[model samples]
Structure formats: structure tokens, C-alpha cells
Target: MFHNSGKLLFFLGKADRLRITVWLFSLTVITIAVPLAFGNLYPTQAERDVMAQTLSNPALTAMVGPVNFETYTIGTMTAHEMVLLTALVVGLMNILFVNRHTRVEEEEGLLELVRSLPTGKGANMMAVFLHILFINLLLVLLISVGLGVLGIESMGWNGSMLYGMVLGGSGIFFAGITAISAQLADNARTSFGIAFAVLMIAYLVRAVGDVSAETLSWFSPLHLSSQAEVYGANHWWTILPLFGVGILLFAVAGYMASLRDLDAGLLRSRAGKTTASSFLGTPTGLALRLQRTGIISWGIAMLLLGASYGSILGDLETFFEGNEILQQMLAGESSASFTEQFLSLLIVVIALIATIPALMSMLKLYKEEKSHRVDLLYAHPLSRFQFFASHLSIAAVQGLVMFLLAFAGLWMAGVAVMTEPFSFLTIVGAGMAYYPALLVMVGVTVLLIGFFPEKSGWVWAYLLYAFIVLYFGGLFEFPEWMEYLSPFGYVPELPNEDMTWLPLILLSMVALVMVTIGFRGYKRRDLQG
Candidate 1:
């Protein structure tokens, strides 16, 4: 078992995308650093009290966990902000890692090739688990050391260690969950969907539970380690439950892996209808069919987020009133009610999330091409334009669907929760307002795939850059041009500011031109695969 695990680990290491891993790790560090930096910027006791009061807002608490006003220090503030977000980052990493090595390898036929070698039945599974465990260890070390070094005086080593364990332990828990999911679902996408659903459920439960009752938070792995209450009345016992649950999940995953055959999942794929519909033969139909599940997954997540944000609208005014700092900032921007401002800001964030599915749809084209599936399809007399256009169309349509559905969810919540009159047209308009920016994201992905197929994954970095620029640019005091690099920058914050048609028109034109260039490049270039 040791020898087999070692061999498999070497293979996994070789196949891993080191660049992306490093980027993601750096992102985790940056995310942690931002709040610490913000906290440090406001060292006054008065400022800390104000920030702590703001953090206690139900709306804010719903996003992260509740703040401890009793221990209202910079470290506590940093921990309150960083805990959930860092858990999310590490959770995503573990999910992607397990899925890629387990299900994705099986789907791509590499798992079979590895199995043909002198390896034990569970060698591959154990190796992935070991690799992830090692990664989490490194994550713990980095986070602990980084926090200690950056916040030695405020948070202390004990608090830092506890916080690091909270993040790394949650990641380990999710790694085990994803491992089980990989064995249960035949395809990588399905495995990811299942794992993501579990992650979301756990997170939502933690969020709701943390806001309502202290005991309710115990059920979620995300909130389990956070029970340590770093920098306050620290309870070291919380770490025990987290690691214990993680080990149990890992053991269960191994047992499940032993039960399943390679490439055969517990949830077996169903056979398609014997007679194909005529439209199924067309590229557009095929693209839509392939993207249907992905669309639904993204849509559901958007709806959940939108509804959560909407339900909290009743607290927006109260939240603003409690935090004079936020009110001052909003006052400087617009005369609109706090509710409208909150909605406007949140919709932009929703738009950012909506861009993800659109980008994935476009990136799907790259994956298809690299997998040589496109070559096979081209052999069957399909034009390059038709093949390309089909996927791009799916992305565009998916983006529109995501935005509209998200707005619908928010509108429904507003009607349910708010006494004030809510305008459906206003919500629809806000959703539509995001279309051009989303198209620009899709266009950028297409442009990358066409011109730099080998390096197309860099589009993720661009998206991350856009996220930082759009959300933190003002806080960080970035140059106007840097903010402009994000398509969302040009978008008018609708419902607060009157809609501007010119920017939308120009953004649409930019997307069109980008698509044209990308298509032309894809057409003229030699097939990569």
C-alpha cells in the first residue's frame, strides 16, 4: 500500500497544474491579508467599536459569521471576516483537486491507464487523499505562520493556530466529501455538482445557525473549528470535533472507493432514447444539451444568493444607521434609499457570480478542443464557425438566464419580506443591466481560447483581477484605468444611479468585436489538438 501510494502520488504531482495551484494559494493569502490590512488601517478603539457594530448587522452576519463585540479587537475583526472566506477558498481547492484526480482522470481514460500499472485497487484513491492531506497541511502551516507573522501582537500565536486549523480542517472535511462524491457520480461535472451542493448546504446551515443559535452551528464542518472563538474565550475542544469528523469522512470515502469499480459510479449513467431528435444533430442543440446541467447548477446557486440578499433588505436601513461609516460612503455616492443602494451593490456582485457560468461555458469549448473531441466532430463535416458559435451561444444564453433568474429570486424575496412596493421592472432592468458586462467576460474567454489556447486558463486570473478591481478598487484606491479594465466598472449602478445606455451600447460593441476576432483566429489557426 505504501509503495502504491508513493507511485500514485508521483503521478498525481506530475499531472497537477502547479501554476493554478500557486495562484489559488496566493489568492487565499491575499484574501486574508486584505481584512487584516483594513483592520490595521483603523487601529483606534472607537473605529474598532464602530466596525464591530457594523459586523453585528444581521445582513453582514448572514454573509460571514457573527462578530464578538465583547472581544472587539483587530484580530477578532480579521478572524470574523477571514474565517468563512478562507474556508470557502480551501474548500473549493479540495473539491477541485479531488474531482480532477479522481473523476476527471477516470473520464479522460487516464485512471484506467494508471490502473493497468502495478498498483493496488485503492492506490489511486489513497494517493489522492494523501496528496490532499499534504496540501491541507501546507495550507495550515502557511496560514498559521502568515497570521502569526502579520498579526503577532494582536491575534497571538494561539489565535492564529486556531484560525488556521479552522480553515485547513474544513478543507479536509470537504476533501473527504468530494472523494465520496467522486465515487458516487460517474462524470466529473456530476461529481462537482454533488460536492458543491453539499458544500453550499453546509455553508448555508452554518450561516443560518451562527446567526440564530450558537448550538446550531455545531452541525456544520465549516463552523465546527470556528467554535474555537479565536482571540476571545478560546475553546480548544472545537478542533477535536473538526479533525474527528474529517477522519471519519475520509474513512467512509475509502470504504466507498473500495466498493465501486473504476469509472463506474454508484449513480450510473442512464441510456439515452434510442431515437435521436432531429435538432440533436445540430451543433447549437448539442451545445445546449451538454451545458444544460451546468446551467441549472449555476442558476440554482445564483437564486439562492439572490434570495438571501433580498431577504436581508429589511435590515439594510438599520445596518446603515448602525454603521455611520458605511452610511457616509453611500451618501457620497447617491441620494437613493439604503435599500436601493444595497440592492444595486448586491446585483453587481450577483453579476460577478453570473460571469462564472458564462466563462465556464466558453472554456468548455477549449476543453472539447484539447480533448480532441472537436477534431472528431470536425471530421464529420462540421464547420469551425458552427462549432465555435454553438458553445458561445450557450454561454450567452446561460448568462442571460442566470441574471434573470437571480433577479427573479430577489424580486420574489422582496415581495415576501418587504412591506414597501418593489418594482418587477426595476429588478428585470437590473438583471438586464448585467448582460453586456457578462458578454464581455464571455468574449474575453473566447478571445483567450482563440489566440492563446495553450494559456487560455489565464482567463481565470483575469476574472480574479476583475473581482478585486470591481469590489475593492475604491477601498484600495486603485487607478481609474485599472478599474476600467473590468467590464463591470463601466456599468452604471442601476436603481441608485439612472441607467446609462451609451456604456451598455459601447460594451455590447466591444463584446461583438472581441467575438469576431476570436472566431477569426480560431478559424485561421492550426488545430491545437
Candidate 2:
């Protein structure tokens, strides 16, 4: 019975339930392609020599890893840069894959049905664990052969082999963490929170330790990825700790699951709301109630993150103090105002930060529709169009409030940096200029949810959207036509460029069109299964 149960789990995964496995291959190729393209872009000896000779600042080393400046070339940057990004992609895959197999399946009743049959306590989990192991193995071979084929075989085979082990270990460790979280939480939502809490802790420990040059990073999974500094001083033994902790967690999770009753979580959830929310009486009220907690949490966190980032502005010069080119690069024209440069960076960051709320707002459409909560709303007086618009209204307005809080946070921090309160409004205005772009993004998610209600969900669209903003717009400097494809691109480069209302109005119009079409589709279709 246990043997067939395990085999059934394997077959289910092979059936392409989420088409999630394909995402792994796609991500691996993209990771390889980014470095491969850059490596080819600068192949000249002198060009490589200049990069190899560039002095490493602590901030730069902390951001990218410690460079072997003498031997460091574009190839090294490619690998080092990928270390962090690759870890992020791999970690995301780990969490989502595990959660999908365990927690989300239980939430949706799939796990309960499977478990009713004769099976081992952690059959599904064993399948998930082994599935990820196979993926990680595939990744190791892919990246190693990929670099070797691309003619960038500059690192020791042993070091490169260790690099692959570290990458696989990183993902597997997070998967084990997710498995532990699945046992603790009663539902997928709580499980996600538990897992994400671990991720946040990992980053905070790693980032703070790196920023302060402390030993705290020794405890974080994120640190293990970049701490080796990849191309420089590759520690071959880091894989052992990651693998050991991950295996320990996996064993503990299986033991806990075996001890628990079927369909029951280790953490018991109790009914709440002895009294009712005032807004619980109406669909709009209920929607607001459902959304307000998320909005408030996001707003405050963004404000705090913005404040933290803003507080660090005056420190950038210190980071680049001895590097004249870097200083000039950041300061931009000794003649240009230093205050403006700092303000520009803050405003841009806060503006991009605002999109997160907008993305969450977009995602709510799926949560409500998929959960059949929207059906409850439709049972009332509201039309489908009205219902969809109501959700859209909350999202759009929430985006405005999110940016406002971000601006307020930046304003509060800017007073210390600007040494005057006058520039607060100036900075806020620049940040606010991003609203049109934010609105358009909100609309895109709404439109997708309205039409392709069953595809990959909001995460895929947001992933693509976010990558373009983070890399293409920020790092690659794409052309205007290409940049305009991103909702963020429609935004004026605040403080760096002057404001224009034409683009804003145009974007607003597009958003209006998207919302109209989205509602039309929602009104025509039945509620999701």
C-alpha cells in the first residue's frame, strides 16, 4: 500500500498539476542566459582587464560578493550576480512547490482524499522532497555544463561543483522549512505566513550581518549563497551544514505528521469574531474587512522599509568615499546637486515600492473568485460589473494610500537628510507621479484575473512584470517603446526627469479601458469552479 501510494504521488506530479516543474527549467535557462549574454558583450582583453582591475568597495563587495579583483572578469560578475538572484528564484520555487503539494492541497481537500487511502504518514511530502531533489540535480548539471559550454570555465571544477551543491542545498533547505511550516499551520494562508517569516528572518540576519560586518550571517540560508563569494574563495564544506539542517527538519516534519490525526494540523485554529465587523453586513464592507488587514500591514511595512532605506542615503557617499568613479557615478556631475541625487534615488525606490500594494490588490481578485466569496457577493444586490469594480476601487485606492505612506516615510527621513522640511513635498510629489503606472498595473492583474481565471494565477504575471522593472528598466536601460510595456515604465523618472501629465492621462485612460473590459468579461462568465 505504501509503495503504490508513493508511486501514485510520483505519477500525480508527473501529470503536470501546476505545470510548475516547467518553471524550474525556464528559470535555469534564464539564469544561464543573463551571464552568457553579458559575457559575450565584453570579450575584449582590455575590457575584461578594466573590470578585473576595478577596486572593490565593502558596499560593492557586500552587494555582489568579495571579488578576486585580479582575476575577476565579466564572467565572475555573471556568476556572483546570479548567486543572489538564483537563490531567490530557487527559494521561491522551493516554498511554492512544497506548499502546493502539502498545505494548499490540504486546504483544497486533495491531501485529505489522498491520505484516506492506505499510505505512510508523509507520503506526499516524500514525493515532494524527492521531486525537488531531482530538480536540484538537474540544475547542478545544467549550470555546470552550461558554463563549460559557454567557454567561461574560469573557476576550479571542485569550486564550481561546490557552487552547484550550495544552490541545490539552498532550495532543499527552504523546502524542508516549508514542510515544517505545513505541519504547524491549519491552512495554506497561515502556512505561507510561517514560511515567509522564516524567509524574512533569513534575509534580515544575512543583510544586517553583511552591512555591519558581523557574524550573524553564519545563521542565515541567504548568507550561505553569497557568503562564499562564488568566484572568490569558494568554501567546499558549506553544503554540509545546509544539507544537515534540511534533513533534520524533514525528519522532524515527517515525525510530527505521523503523530497528528488525518486532516488535522499540529497548530489548532479556533473560531474567532464573537462579535462581527460593522462592514460584514455588505459585500463592499466585507471586502474592505477582508482587505484592510493586508493593506495596513503592507502600508506600515513599506513605510518602515522606506524610512530604513531613506535613513541610509547619507551613507552611500561613505560607501563610495574612496572610489572616485563610483562617487561620480552616484553623485552624477559634481556640478549637479548632491541633495537632488539622493532625493532621486529615494523617490524612485518609494515609487517602485508602491507597486507592491498594487500587486497585492490585483491578486485579491483571484483569492475572492477562487474561494467563491465573490459568489456570496453576487447573491446580494450587486451586479457582477459592480462587484468587480468595487474590488478594483479598493485596489486602486489602496495603491494611492500605499504610496502616500511611502512618501510620508521618505518625507520624515528626508528632513534629516535635506536638513529642511521644504523638500518633503517635493520628494512626495515626485513619488506620487508614479500613480498612473501603479493604476495601470492594478488594472492588468484585474484584466487577467477576469479573463484567464484558470491559468498560472497572479504570481506569473507579477513575476514577469517585476523582473522587467528591476532589471530591464533599472539595470538595462531599455528603449522607450520597450520600457513603455511595463506599467512602471509609464511613470516619470521622478526628480531625475521632469513631470508630464500627458503620459499620466494616457495611462489612466488605458486603465479605464482595462477595467471596463474586465468587468464585461466577469459579468458574462459564471463564477469560477
Candidate 3:
């Protein structure tokens, strides 16, 4: 069943080396950087305790995970603050990584070519499993060794290994989930949807369980990973369930794969209507139909994300009232309230989240082109510009709607929780201030799709860079010039700093130029599959 698996593994590694490197490097850097900063940020045990206490509220527990600090050391703080979020990220990485290799390859007909050779029936999957295992192991080694090298007294080598193991276990667990999802869904999109839905459900369940009931958390892989309590009790036993369940799931996925035929799923796809609706006749309508499921999913996610952040807003004033470290990190000026300063930060985050769907919408054009779907459309009455406009327009409109839904969710939840709620219009205006920045991202995606469709993936890299620089710049005290690298940095931190129109206008102009150039490129370029 595993014949030639080594060759397939090497092939996959070669294809995905860059992505694997980025994930491992980013996760390790973040894991190590936090602890390194924590030692200096909260130098004394007293300060660490206060920081832990400030973060112990139900809202934060729901947002990150339950704080498991007994002595409130730097190690405990790092574990509490970083583990759950990082695990969630690692889980997502595994889901995408697995789905891309398994279901996506099958959908694109690559797996079929490999199978025509003398490879075993299960060779491809076995290779994927080995590839994922290798990546997770590398992640574990990098994070563990990186933290140990930091030489933080509280973050000892023993705890560092456990911390890295927790994340590695989480990644393997989610990789198994995606493996099963790949066997269950015929299409790459549906396969990814199923895997991501599971990821989101795990996070939501863990959040609810941590804030409400400890017993419920035991069911969530995310919660189970956090139970490792790396620097606290060093509950080494908690990691067993993650590895065990993951292996079980992998076995189940393998069995399912053996029983099914190539390019087919255990779960059947729904049959479409024999006759087309009038709405599907036009480019805009066709684009909407193709993207509606993703758009709806992103919209719901944005709303919930905004509400989650808003739920914690009521506690921010008290949380930041006396913590000099937090105050200095979040404070903008002497006059800005802590809540306002935090809102400014939150808006940057919300805007960035909103940008994803917008970017996805624009990138759909490239996906269609790569799949040769655009070729068929061009045979009809559709022009390249019309096809391009359809996706771009949807992206633009959906981006605005995302902001509105997110801000609306934020306002509704915030009003219920705060003693003195902020004005709805104020929050909306503050959020909308970042809309132009979102357009800048959309423009970049459009530019990539027009001129460099094969390299469309680079847009996501740029977005990730923008997120890190803009979101963590203040926390890391990144240089001021670094902020200007992303459009989000151009906008004033509204409601904390005075709103500036010049930056917004400039961002809009930049977006316009990119879109215009992308349109011209799309019109002139020969179609490639």
C-alpha cells in the first residue's frame, strides 16, 4: 500500500518547501519571541502575577484559552498567551497543507497521473501522511530548540519541548481531520470547507468550554492541547490523547481511501439543475454563484470574530487601569482612553480579517483561469474585462459588507456589555476608516491576477507581512518605517488618533492604479491553464 511513497514524499517536499519553511519559521519565531519579550516586559514576579490576574477573566479565557499559571512565571505567561492561538494557527496550516496535497491534487488530476505508474493504491496518501509528519516534526524541533536557546529561566528545556510537542500534536491531529475530509469530499473546495469547519467548530467549542465548563473542553483538540500546561504543572500526559486520536483518525482516513475510487468521495455531491436560471446567465451572477458559499462563510466568521473581540471590550478598562506594561504597549497619547486605544488596535485586526475574503474574491479569477474555466467563458460572449470586473466588483462590495457586519456585531455586543457603550456611529466610522486599506489589498490581488496569475499566491504572503507589521508593530516596538510597508499603517488609528483624510485618499489612488493596470494586463495576456 505504501510503494514508492518515498518518491511521492520527496516530490511533495520539493513542491511545498517554501510554504513549509515559512510556516515553521513563523511559528517558531513567534513562540520564542513572546517568551523573550515577556522576561523584560514583566521583569518581576509581582508584575507577572498582575499580568496573569489581568488576563484571567472569562472573556480572555474564551478568546485565547484558560490561563494555567500557578506561579505566574514568564514561562507560564508565554504558555497561557501563545499556546492556544498558535495551536489554532498550526491546525489551520495543517488543514490547508493536507487538503492541498490530497483532495486538491486529486481534483486537479495530478494524483491520477501518479497512480498510472507502478505506485501502490495508497502510495499518494501514505506520502502525504509522511510529508505532514515530517513538517510537524520539524516544527516541533524548531520551536523547542528555539525556546531553549532563548535561555529564559522559567522557559526551561523540559517545558520548551512539551510546548513544541503540544503544537506538533495539534498539527498532526488537524492533518488527520483534513485527510478524512479529503476522502469524504469529491472537490477541493468542499474538502477544505469541511476541514476548516471542523477547525472553527473546535475553536468555538473550546472557547465556550474554557469560559463555561471544564468538562466540555476535553472534547476539543484545541482545549486538549492547551491542557498540557507546559510551564505550569507540565502535564506531559495531556499530549497523549492528541497523538493517539490523530493516529486513529489517520487510520480511519486510510481505510476510507482504500474503499473508495479515485476522484470520488464517500459523501456524494448534490446534482445541479438540468436547466439554468436566468440569474446564472450573466458574469456577475455566475461569479456570485461560484463564490456565494465562501462569501457567506467569511461574512459569518467576520461577525463572530468582531463580537468575540467586542465581548472583551467591557473588561479592557479594568484590565488596563493600572498595568504599566499594558498601558505603555496600548497607550497612544496621555489623552487617549485605554478602551479607545484598544479599539484602534482592534479595528486594524478587524480590517485585516475583512481583507481575506476580499482577496479571496479577487483571486477566484486566477483559480478559474488556472482551471481553464475562463477559457469556456471566453468562448461565449464574455470579454476578459467583463470576467475580471465580475470578480473584482464582488470583491469590492463584499469587502465593504464584511466591515459593516463586523462593526455591527462589535457594536451590538459591546453595547450589551459596557456600562457606557460607545456610539454606534463612532465605531462604524472608526472601522470604515480602514476600508481604503482593504481596497489596497484587493488592488494587489487584482494586480497579481492580471499580470502574474501563476504567482497569485504571493498576495497572501504580502497580506501576512502586512498583518504582522501592522498588528504587532506596536507590541514589538517595530521601527516607524516598517509600518508604512502596509497600507493599513497609512490610516490614522481612529477614535484614538484624529482621523486623517490624506492617507485614505492616497491609498484609494494607489488601489485605482493597480486595478487599472491589472485590467489591461488581463485583456492582453494569453490564457494559461
Candidate 4:
């Protein structure tokens, strides 16, 4: 039964011949190649010293998970950091892939055809598991090969094994999560929401525990990935727990899959208010309904991230005080107050966090159009201007909201330590200063939806572009013009530098032009079949 089922999934994934292969290959490269290259580049003693100091900061550890500084091996360090960040990329893949195969297949009205074949109740489960397993195994082998090529020797075979298992386990665990999520929701969107929220919660729990060590980390799979102790202890036993948990989750998911009706979840969705008030008649009103839930969710996430960053800010000075190289990298000049410089770096870090919501909001616009909901929206007397404006309003307002949530979190953390009263508002102002670039990002995404639908199909490209920009700016010494392409480039360096209005105004004008172009082009272009 499992064999036949696996064969079906293998064929189904081949539906997008060029696109799917490219997507997996790209993720494979990112999960493996960048670390290998970085390991080779930073082989010097001075480079290691700078990274050691950076990793010592509490927030860095919280964000990247634990490090094995003593081993001085880049691969081990990469494992620690990639375990957290790669899990994010992998988790999203699992959610999307599983939902595509299971819930989405049924939603498209293809389940009946498949059911007519000689298949059992567990075919779908077996199929999804096999597909995800293949992916995880392939990633493990590719990453191990990449690591070996980097020339950083691991301690015995344990280092390589631990690295592979931790990274691969992340995908396996999330596959199980998506399987359960698929069984719990009728639609792909709802299941994605549930699975993604769990992913966020996992990161948050691990972050909080990293800062406080309150034992809250044990509840999350994230803890398992990092507890492998890559080069430190190379704890072989931890992998068993992750494997055990993933298997149990899959079993439960299989049980639920068998119990649920085709294309249905455990909880039936009840119809809400049938009547639309006067506010719902306006374009903004409808936009609010469509975008409000996402805005609120991102706002809350930013606040939590801000709080996490703030929890470690007080210790950063201590972490970098002894290392002259780190001081130069962080503060730049001794003539200025180191404290002010450190706080400025903190603001830059938080601002980067705030950019995520901006990108997410922009991506939502593409989703709205791709799902074929925009046609219904435009059918109502709403002009193209209204339609475009509605989404732009959502993106701009939500970006601001997320910024404020981050500010609010930082403010609360500051108050707890009885820091200066004005410190919080200053950070908020600095954060708000980046709104123009964020809005431009939203506009860029909108334009992509209209003019380059095929390009927008690759969501991972957005992330990859960002990664390349970041790496080039800091690691490869790229020219300023190339870096300017990233929205983060236009943001004013906060805390340490004075604020400016010129850049913001210019960016706003650019965004307006982009939006105008997208709206006009989309209104005139032929709808895709």
C-alpha cells in the first residue's frame, strides 16, 4: 500500500517540471552551499575572533541557537545557526508541499479520480510521508557533501552525523506537523495558517528559553535540533527523541487522516455574520477584512521578536568590550560613545525584523491575485485604483503596525530595567523612519504581481535575494549600488545617526510610481488561464 501510494506522490510532484525542480534545487543550494562557502572564507584567526564575539551576545545565541566556539570549526557553527534558520525554510516547504499534495489536491476536485483506483485509506498519508522523506534524505546527503568540501574537519564521524540529523530532522518534524494540519483543516489556507502559527510558537519558545533558560525549550522541536551539541558534546541520544517524536506525530496524523471525511478537517467551519455593515461596502472596508488577521498576526510576532532582542541588549556591551576587532565592527570609532553605537546597532537589528512583515504583506498581495479572488473583488464597482489602493493601504498600515509592536515590546523591556523614559520613543521614531523603503517593497511586490506573474511564482526567490544582498554587503564587500536594491539599504542608520526626511520622500515618490504602473498594467493585461 505504501509503495503504490509513494509512487503517486512522486508523479504528482513532477506536475511542475521546471518550477518544482528549480525550487528544490535552490533550497538545496542555500541549505548547503552558502555555509560551505562561508566556512572557507572565514578561516583566519581574526575572522573567528570576530564571529566568536558576535555569537557571545545573548540575542545572537537566542536567534541562532547554541554555538561550539571552542571547536573553532565553521561547519559546527553553521549547523547551530542553520538548525534554527533552515528549519524555517524547511517548515514552510513541508506546509506548502503537504498541503499541495493532500488538501489542495482534494480542493481541486481530483480526489474522486484517485479514489477510484485500488488504494487504501492510508495512501495519501503514505504518499506525503514518502515525498517528504525523500526530500529530507536528499538534503542531508547534499549538505553533508557540501560541509566536507568546505575543508573544516569535524570531530570524528559524530560531527557529520549530528549536523545531518539535526538539519534533516527539522524537515521531517515539520512534515508531520503539516500532515496533522492537513487533517485538521478543510482548506489549504486554514491548514497553512495553523502550521505556520505552530512554527512561530516553536521559535518563540526556544528564544525565550535561550534568554532565560526556564525549561520552556523542551516543549519545542527547535530545542531538539540545537541539543545535538554539534561539536561540543555531539550528543547522539538527542536524535532519538526527535525521531521518536516525529514518528509518533506521523502515526497520529495517519489516524486522523483515516478518520476525517475527504477534503474535510476535524472542526467544521461555522458561517459567521451574513450581513455586511456600511463599512464593508467600501474598498478599504473589504481590504480591512481581508488583511486585518494577517496584520495582527505579524504585529504580534514583531513585538515578540523585539522583546527577545531587547532582553539581550543590556549584555552586548559586555560581550564585545574585550575584543578590539568586534568593537571596530560594531562601534566603528572610539571617539563616539560606545553605548550609543551599540543601541544604534540594536535599532538596525530590530528594523531588519520589521522588514519581514513588509515583505510578508507584499507577498499577500500576490497571493490575493493568484488565488483568483481579485476578479471577484474587481467585479464589484471597485476601480483598479481602489483595488490597488486597498492592498497598498493594507501593506503600509500593517508595516507601521508591526513597527509599533516592535517598539512597544522594546519599550516594555526598557521599562522593566528602569531605563531612561525617552529611550523607548526614540527607538520608535527610528523604527518608523524606515516606513518609506518598506512601502516601496510593497509596491515592488505589487508590480511583480501585475507585470511578472511567472516570476512571482517563486516565493523563495524573494528570500534568496535578501540573503544574497545581506551576504554581499557584509561578507563579500559589494559596491553600494548593488546593496541599495534591498529595502533595508535605504533605512537610516538609527540611534547613532541623525534622522533624515529626504530619502523617505524620494522613496515614497518611487513607490507611488511603481504602484501606478502596476495598477494600470494589471487593468489592461489579459487574465491568465
Number of the top lDDT candidate = 3
lDDT of candidate 1 vs native? 0.79
Candidate with more favorable, higher lDDT: 1 or 3:
3
Best by TM-score: 3
| lDDT for 74 (candidate 4) | 63
Candidate 3 lDDT over residue span 476-500, tens digit each: 7788898798888889887898878
- The pairs that clash in candidate 3 are none
The count of residue-pair clashes in candidate 4 stands at 0
Arrange candidates by lDDT, descending.
Answer: 3, 1, 4, 2
Model 3 / residue 156 / CA error / Å: 1.1
For model 1, how does the per-residue alpha-carbon lDDT over 1-529 read when each residue is reduced to its tens digit? 4348888887777767575477447756675666556664576768778778777777677777887547677777777776787788778888988898888888888888887888877788789878887788777777778778874466788887887778778888888889888888988899999999888988888888878877777777777545567767667777676567777877787788788887789887889999878898899888788878888888889888889878877756767765544554342467888888777777887888888888999999988877677777889989998999899888898888889888888888888878884799998798788799889888888888889988787777787788777666555556779968888888888788888899999999999999999989989888876
Model 4 lDDT per residue over 1-529, tens place? 4436866776765764454566567666666655555555676666765666678566677788756546655656566666678767777776777777777777656665687787767886787777777777776776665555555565345576677677677778877887788888887667777888988889878877876784988888888777777766777787776666766778899898778788688878777688998988787787777666666777777887777666655644556655443354343643545555656566656666676666665665556666576778778777777766776777777778888888778767755643443376677887788777767766777677778865654534554565465443444445668757776577666666767778889999998898788777777876653
Clashes of each: 0, 0, 0, 0
The list of candidate 3 runs beyond 4 A from truth reads none
User: Deviation in angstroms for 354 in model 3?
Assistant: 1.1
In model 3, the Cα lDDT at residue 424 comes to 94
* Model 4 worst lDDT run, 10 consecutive residues: 325-334
Residue 197 of model 4 has an lDDT of 94
